[model samples]
Target: MLRADNLTKKYGDFTALNGLDLSVNEGDIFCLLGANGAGKSTTINLFLNFIEPTDGQASINAMDVTLHDRETKQLLSYIPENLMLYPHLTGLENLDFFCGLGGKSHTQDQLESLLRESGLQADFIHRRVSSYSKGMRQKVGIALACAREASVLLLDEPTSGLDPKASNEFSELLLTMKKRGVATLMATHDLFRAKDTGTHIGIMKEGVLVEQFASEEVSFRDLEKLYLQHMHN
Candidate 1:
């Protein structure tokens, strides 16, 4: 459902991403692991059309992202490193507002159901977003994705601040989305979570994809060792 074809991006003398060819099909969770300036976020920005690609293309469902910006956006959802929401609004209110932006309108009960399915506690749905923990805010973000019926999810540093329990819960929620055939491309620094939730894993270095493989084929220790080796080179 998501694809990057020879995707390259350069800011004058600095290349943020280079010749990245990737595909994330329905029900697949592709985890991108890399250090700072490794181009993970740049790839996502290309797909998001937040910035134009210098060369090549990013697409959703065979539709060119740059060319079909509006149509492509309707097919996917994005959750950045810091998920933003109106601090004064309740979780339910936030859902209602975001979904509305996508031209979707849901009843209160239906909206509440989405939040619950995303792992937010029932009582917390009515609480103001400013009072939410990072994990709780992420759940509401997931609910927004669900409300949009988005087939593709682009996540950057999704588990950066979560505790072990919250992180595990987040992983479980991602698996649930995968079961429903959501194609997920997650950029994360957490190798353990990548191993737990990803179907495929990719490592990037200096703006290029250096290695990729099926996640099930490698143990966590092995993956970590390889990641460290790439970082040092």
Candidate 2:
């Protein structure tokens, strides 16, 4: 679970986030939508303690992110817009490296199994990342998160460059994580993916949360219309 109360951040004259308040419960897929510089990543950065908030506070399960940085970080796993892998290493090797970095060491087979769990195919397990596609790389990213047993997943445009099949597979993997009750906070530009994968959606603009809704309470079509109106406001 995560909560932010009146969260605000500013860079001199530029306000990245302003009085943004939100709560994400366990197993909730919260999609944060906005234009190019709507402070989506700023919110994440504040929560991740990558940047300290100029105002207000963010917490993970009642622990303040700023005050309890280590504990809060341990509760989260992040997938940024662009993930980097060791180009020369195999997919399984990448998985092992990140897992070990997290103070968890798994054997070769264990890491490969973790990859399989994240929907990475066994056949592609040993191939170099240099030869893998974008989607394949992201699958390994997800595999790293699972291997670390992260409780909260923060993703930014996770499905961006994937082909159709890979995108769908990635979506299915997210569904599995949801079933397992991992709280997910995702910032994505793909509306269709947000519609199907998100339990709730929030529209943000100029550092403010303009509107929000439960997926069940509003149709995707209506959300799109509202999104259009909000951005142009």
Candidate 3:
């Protein structure tokens, strides 16, 4: 579970995020829809403790992230827009290394199984990451999340560059995580994908959360119209 209570962040005269209140519970995929500088990444950074909040709190599983940085980190996994992995290492090798950083040790078979469950092909699991497409790298990232048993996942622009097929594949993978009780908070520009995969959708503009609703309550066209209205306002 993830919660942000009146979270605020400011950089000198510029307010990056202001009074953000959000919650993502188990089995929830919350998608944040916003353009550049809409405070989406700032919200995530605050939750990750990558940057401290200027006001209020960012919590994971009811523990304040600022007060329990290490413990909160142990309960979550993050995937940024650009997933960085050891390019020369095989997918399995990368999974093991990242998982190890989280103090998770897995055998070759166990690691491979995680990758497979993350929607990776067995043939590519042993291949070096340098030869992988972005989608492949992201699958390994998901595997690392599973290997760590992360209960919360924070994703920022995860489907930015993937083709439709790969994007859909990634969406399916997220549904799998949801079924396993992983709460997900994702910042994405793909409205269609958000509608397809998110349980809740929020529109943010100029550092404020302007609109939010259950995905099924609004059609995709309605969501897009509301999003554009907020962006223009």
Candidate 4:
């Protein structure tokens, strides 16, 4: 399970997050939506420990993030909006080296299979990242996350640059992972994808979670309307 207990962040007199609390269970995809500067990224950053909280706690499986940095990091795999890789290196080598940096090593065949599982084309596995498209790079990012073998997956704008077909493929990969009991917390601007992929949805406004809804209870169109209503108010 992943939980954020009244997590708060402040910048001098400005508050980026205030008493934001959430819980995501295994096999759950919790998609967060918000207008610009709503603190969706801040919430994810708190879990990644990129920034310390002014108050409250974020944890995985009940392991407090502040006290369990190494252990918490071990349980998480983060895919940022722009997943950076060495353009000079082939996809395989990039995954190999990055995962190795995290103390994970894999055989060539294993790496290829993992990439394919994450929706990368088998043919592109040997291509240099410079020649690959955005969707391809994101696939490699997801592949690395898979290689990390963590209990939780954090996706930030995960489908930002993919074509319709590619985006659908990525969504399918996420659904597949959910079936395997992986916890997912995705911060995205795409409400359509959020409704389809999210087991739960949250709307953040000006550093607060103003509203939340269950995916099963609200249709995608309804969620969009509700999202706009929250953003406008």
List model 1 lDDT by residue over 1-233, tens digit each.
Answer: 99999999999999999999999999999999999899999988899999999999999999999999999999888888878899999999999999999998899999999999888999999999999999999889888988999999999988899899988988998998899899999999999999989999999998999999999999999999999999999
What TM-score, over all chains together, does every model reach? 0.98, 0.96, 0.98, 0.97
The lDDT per prediction is 0.93, 0.88, 0.93, 0.90
TM-score of 3: 0.98
Query: lDDT: which is higher, 1 or 2?
Result: 1
Q: What overall lDDT, based on C-alpha atoms, would model 4 receive against the true structure?
A: 0.90
* Residues 1-233 of candidate 2: C-alpha lDDT, one tens digit per residue: 98989999999999999999999988899999999899888988888899999999999988999999988888788888777899999998888877887788888978888888877778899998898888888889888878888889989888888788988998898888888889999988888888999998999999998888887788889888999999898
Ranking according to TM-score, highest score first = 1, 3, 4, 2
Backbone clashes in each candidate structure, one number apiece? 0, 0, 0, 0
Q: Which of the numbered candidates is closest to the native, going by highest lDDT?
A: 1
With candidate 3 superimposed using the best TM-score fit, by how many Å does residue 44's alpha carbon deviate from the native? Answer: 0.9
| Pairwise TM-score winner, candidates 1 and 4 | 1
- Listed per candidate, the RMSD to the true structure in angstroms reads 0.8, 1.2, 0.9, 1.1
| Angstrom error at residue 129, model 1 | 0.8
